[model samples]
Target: MRLSGRQIDCIRGGRGVFSGLDFEASSGEVLAVVGPNGSGKTSLLRLIAGLLVPAGGSVALEGGDAELTLPEQAHYLGHRDALKPALSVHENLSFWRDFLGGKTGDVGQCLAAVGLGHATHLPAAFLSAGQRRRLSIARLMVVRRPVWLLDEPTSALDTAGQALFVGVMRDHLAGGGIVIAATHAPLGIETRELRMGSAT
Candidate 1:
């Protein structure tokens, strides 16, 4: 399967990020989006994930598939961990499993993948910023989704955390999943760049 955006466009605050933009991301490919701060990299990801519609363009899957919605058929991991501070790590993941279509992921394995297994029972508030990022990242390892839209996935992560994220992205690609991540540093994937604000 593949996702292709032809002549895609988006406008934020009446400023055009890009127009007439074109790109394709096939299965097993990890496409990374890079740009300076405030360069609309996150905006582009949002558009591709269907979180924001382009001002005048089209984005569609290659296999006659219908368009995508914000959280349908795609998993978006933003800067925020999206964890409940009041809930324990296990409870947070469990709640997501219950809420997100009742599809359960390997909670234990995921925690371990992100090196958060020992703290599974700890409240989110107790975890450090870097740890919280890992836990949020672990959500990707457990949940099975076709597309991953990540924003600054490595922020607040230490060296080990970055490596773990790299591994997860590699695993996802190996499984024929597609990833579109907006990041400042390298995302450890062969990417087809989409430069925002360029002649699109």
Candidate 2:
């Protein structure tokens, strides 16, 4: 399947962030959105994930599930971890699994995959930034989604944590899943770069 955005436009707070943007991403491919601050990198990903409405243009998926919209088929990992500080790592993940409305996955296995298995009972607020990020990564594994929209995915990760995340992303792509990330750091994988701002 392929995701395409044609002549897209983004306006925020009555000001235009970007306009006439165009791009396409297909299955088993990693699309990296690279741009400086205020260049609308996050805006573009949000548009593709259906979190933001385009002022003009369209985003369509070809050769995919006709019954579900693009956003419904995607897993959006934004800057925030989206976890409840009062809950444990396992609890946070379990909550998302139930809320996202999908077949239940192995939460323990997913936590182990991200190196959070030992911390399953620890409160989310007690974990370090890197550990918290790993918990967020675990959420991606609990529910199967074809499209992954990640913004600064490895922000709080250290060298080892980043390496682990790269493996996770590679496995997803190998499974024919599509990943679209907005990041300033290297993704540790070959990606089709979509540079925004004046160059585009």
Candidate 3:
């Protein structure tokens, strides 16, 4: 599968963030979007995920599910963890699994994979930042999606948690999944860089 964005333009809050940007990533590839702050790295991801409507250009995924749009086939992990503080770890994952409605995996196994098995019943409000990130990672695993749009995926993750996430990403790629991550820190995996320039 190939995900490509051509001559893309992004505008936010009435200001131009970027324009004439082009990018492409195939299956089994990790495209790391890196740039200085305010360079539109996150904006690029949001455009591809269909969260923000682009002012110009287009994004298309070739060789993906024909019945679904790009966003439907993609998982967007944004700056916020997008968790419910009132729900337990397992409940949060369960909600996502049901809501996403795709090829599903075992939530318990996914939590264990992300090192959250022991906290399955714990409320999200009580979890630390790293744990919150881990739960978000677990959400990625429990629901199968081919395209992963991650913004600062390693944020709040400790050394071990970061390392564990590397394995999780590897597994996803091994299964022919594609990852597009916007990050300042190294992803701890081999990746092609898509460096954005300052906003126009």
Candidate 4:
């Protein structure tokens, strides 16, 4: 599968963020969006995920499910963990699995993969930042989405958690998925860079 964005333009809060930007990623490819702050990295991802409508240009995915739109076939993991503080770890994942209808995996196994098996019953409010991030990773595993748009995916992750996430991403790519990540830190995996703005 191939995802492409052409001549994209973004305007936020009545100010232009970016314009005439283009990007493409295929199956098993990791595209890292990097640049200084306010360069529209997150805006680009949001556009591709269909969260924000582009002022100009278009985003498309080829060789994907014809019945679904690009956003429907993609997973957007933003800076926020998007967890329910009132729910347990497993409950949170279960909610996502049910809400996102697609190929599903075992929630327990996914939690174990992300090192959250021991905290399956723990409320999200009591988990640390790193743990919250791990739980989000587990959410990704439980739902099958071909396109992953990650914004600072490694944030709040410790050394080991970051390393573990690398493996998770690798597994996703090995399964022929595409990852588009906006990050300041290294993803700890080989990726093509899509630098934004004028920063060198």
Candidate 5:
């Protein structure tokens, strides 16, 4: 599948964030978005994920699942991990699995992949920064989505966790998935850069 955005524009609070942006990514490819703060990297991802509507232009997927909309086929991992603090790691993952209609994969295996196997029963509030990030990474595994939209995905990850997540991303690419990440850190994978704004 091919995902492309043409002449995209974004406005927030009646103020312009970005305009006339264009990008493309095919299956098995990674598009890394980079720029300084206020460059609209996150805004671009949000537009692609349909979390925010574009003021102008369009994002289209070519030869993808026709029955589902683009947002339905994507996994949006924003800056917030989106975990319920009161819930255990397993509960949080399970809830997302059911909610997202995840029909495959073992929750334990997913947690183990992120090095959080032992903390499955622990409340998310008790997890350390790196551990919380690992848990968030686990959510990506429990449910499968062709498109991954990440914002600062490596924020609190340690070196080992970064390496582990890189492997995970590689596996996803190998399986014909597409990843579009907004990050300041290196992704440790081959990718095409989509720099935005003058600050970049």
Candidate 6:
């Protein structure tokens, strides 16, 4: 499916971060939202994810006119890793399996794919920054969401981690998945770029 935003606007703290932003992202393609900090990148993802209500305009899925709902056909991974600190890596992914409304991905495979297999039984609180980021990304592999909303997905990752994420993302898109990410550097993939700084 495709995600298209038309004249989308979002306000925070009574400030108009952006208004009338428009874009179309289809499966097998990626949209990169890039800008300096406070450029409203995250706000745009939240608007698309339905976590924040837009002050104007709309985000629709594919050819449908209805706005998407939170936890619907979209998977959002924010800058902060959202794993349960006390939960073991195994339990973390297991819980997300059912929560995401899709088939259960093999935790072992997911962990291995993220290069975190050895820490599968460890609590999230003890994982390193990069490791935690990988764990958060593992959530995406657990289910095939049509739209992936990732914020700084490569922030704490090294070259290998970045490579792994790029490979997984390519596979996802090959399977007709869409990705919209807010990033500072190249995500190892050439994407249609959207400069949000100009909107501010």
Q: What TM-score do all the candidates reach, one by one? A: 0.90, 0.96, 0.99, 0.98, 0.97, 0.93
**Compared to the true structure, candidate 6 yields what TM-score?**
0.93
**RMSD of model 4 against the true structure:** 1.4
Question: For candidate 2, which ten residues in a row score worst on lDDT?
Answer: 191-200
Q: What TM-score does structure 5 among the candidates reach?
A: 0.97
Off by over 4 Å in 6: 63-71, 198-200
How many pairs of residues collide in model 1? Answer: 0
Tens digits of lDDT, candidate 3, 134-171: 99999999999999999999999999999999999999
Model 2 quality (TM-score): 0.96
Q: Is candidate 4 or 5 superior in lDDT? A: 4
Q: How many angstroms is residue 37 displaced in model 1 relative to the true structure, after the best TM-score fit? A: 2.2
Candidate 4, residue 32: the lDDT equals 99
lDDT of each: 0.79, 0.90, 0.95, 0.93, 0.90, 0.86
Query: What does the lDDT come to for candidate 3?
Result: 0.95
Ranking by TM-score: 3, 4, 5, 2, 6, 1
Model 3 quality (TM-score): 0.99
**Which is the better candidate, 1 or 5, if ranked by lDDT?**
5
Better of 5 and 6 by lDDT: 5
TM for candidate 4 is: 0.98
Best by lDDT: 3
Write one digit per residue (lDDT tens) for candidate 4, span 101-173. Answer: 7999999999999998899999999999999999999888999999999999999999999999999999999
- How many clashing residue pairs appear in each of the predictions shown? 0, 0, 0, 0, 0, 0
State which candidate, 5 or 6, has the greater TM-score.
Answer: 5
Over 1-200, each residue of candidate 5 has an lDDT whose tens digit, in order, gives: 99999998899888888888999999999999998899899989999999899999999988878988999888899888899999999999988888897345788999998999898999899999888888888888889988999999988899999999999999999999999999999889999999888522
Judged by whole-model lDDT over C-alpha atoms, candidate 5 comes out at 0.90
